[model samples]
Target: MTAARAAALPGSEAPAGDERLGEILRALDEDFLAVLGWDWERRVITWPRQHPVIGLPDCPVPGCPLAITVSTRPMCGGCMERWRGSSLPLEEFLLVPKQTSRGTGQGPCVVAGCGRPRVTVAGRLCLAHHVQHTSAGLRVLSLEEFLAHPGVVGHAEFGPCEVAACYLKAVSGQVPYCEAHLNRLYRARTAPGFDEAHWRRTDKAICTTREVSLRGMPERLVAELLYGLWVRTREGFKSRPECLRPVYDRLRARQVQQLEEVTDPAAHGHGREQVTMIRAGSERCAC
Candidate 1:
């Protein structure tokens, strides 16, 4: 489900509903029944199909309803295994008459806003995003650009470290360097002619952890993120304190000064989450 939709849910934002105020009831499928009593009805409940957070698409081969195995390769796992040895060009392979059987299940695509399942566990992509990765030389930098949001930074936004080329996320509100940089600073504080400015330019970035530095990021983007965070914490459901590095990286590359400017569903995952938080907080403030 979209972040906005998830945040808007009665239980998603806050676990409050009329069902909790009435008599207790039970269903055969006890899963989430108590939580969803307010919205429940007598019916079969097939998950994912009824409400899949993201979906997988069918293979490109005509008359094949089976899903493709790889997003970039544009074929089912069975087909992909066969194509590797056939050595037939992709176009020819697609045109050639072939049959496909039901393949194995796949996980959701990694591209944040994409709604398709990945072809394989290793590639972690949907068909459309895979095409972009292959044709456009896609260098996805945003931590949130994919479904796996890298949770390395701290809850508070401390901006980037001051060390040169050391693009580690600053963990402390007072200190300007990341934990690694701070330790390095402690070791070299008294070295000859070693000042903060000189160190920033002289040192190379040492990315040992899953952290991302916002040192060179534009101020406008940072401001947007800060404002969004402020709104998110008001009440109801709030996002994880740790922001995605790829999310900021993607926004920076796009030169998006504001989150509202983004529209593409696949690229709008972060923005969608922000919208839900803002909307929920607004509702709380009005009450």
Candidate 2:
């Protein structure tokens, strides 16, 4: 019989021809959409031509009876709940823009421990809280500002000449002690007679002197003076038996070199006299 006659016959299987049924079945198996509603004789799967409300033509979510396509997926509420209970399906979820209310456009603040609207980076917390907590906690004050405060000058929290001196030096941005003193402390700490009590005494003295002098000086000047003194004292002490003579000599040489670098003749002239005075003083003092 002819291939067309066999295909048209009711309840009769089509005769094997050049286009084998097995080949057609294999092609249908390869296509997912073709399996939906495929007809062997017709050689076509019926698919909805128009775009469905949901991207998927048919959703396999369980317990969904409605045929209407959903905005995201056609799954009914029941199917969505079931899917969510197991694992989240990518197809079932949709991204939507965040909504805003009309009253006040300001959204909730993201910063922790803050109820106020976030404005600046530092102002994550409310202005009042930020000022009260951070500003007060740090005791933020410039050198001049701190020195000008009566409490800082004579506060019980900062006492003793040595401690006061160190604090002042730190505040004024000066070296706290003569270089000799710094060397002495460094040597003492590393020496055989090193003791906590001795350290405390020495430290106290240095701080007290620095604090007193720093009260009226600029931070930079105070720091430089204290540092110079500390270096001289420290090195002098470290050099033991050599005494201040050698230390003074070294310092003088350094000072002279520095003076030479100054283009101004007057400034250069002043250091020579100071160097002489320092050397004279060192000669009289015992290490």
Q: Report the lDDT tens digits of candidate 1 across residue range 178-242.
A: 65677788888778876776666545344211223333333333333433333443233323212
**Clash count for each candidate, listed in order shown:** 11, 32
Tell me how many residue pairs clash in candidate 2: 32
Candidate number achieving the greatest TM-score relative to the actual structure: 1
In model 2, the runs with Cα more than 4 Å from the true position are: 1-132, 135-156, 161-193, 201-287
lDDT of 2 by residue, 1-287 (tens): 23443345333343345233323222222233222233333221122323221122333443222222333544543445555775655454422211221111122223343334322222222333334334663358653454344443221111111322222111111333333344555666777767745343324222110011222222222222223333333344211111222322333223322212323334233344433433333332222
Q: Could you tell me the lDDT of residue 17 within candidate 2?
A: 53
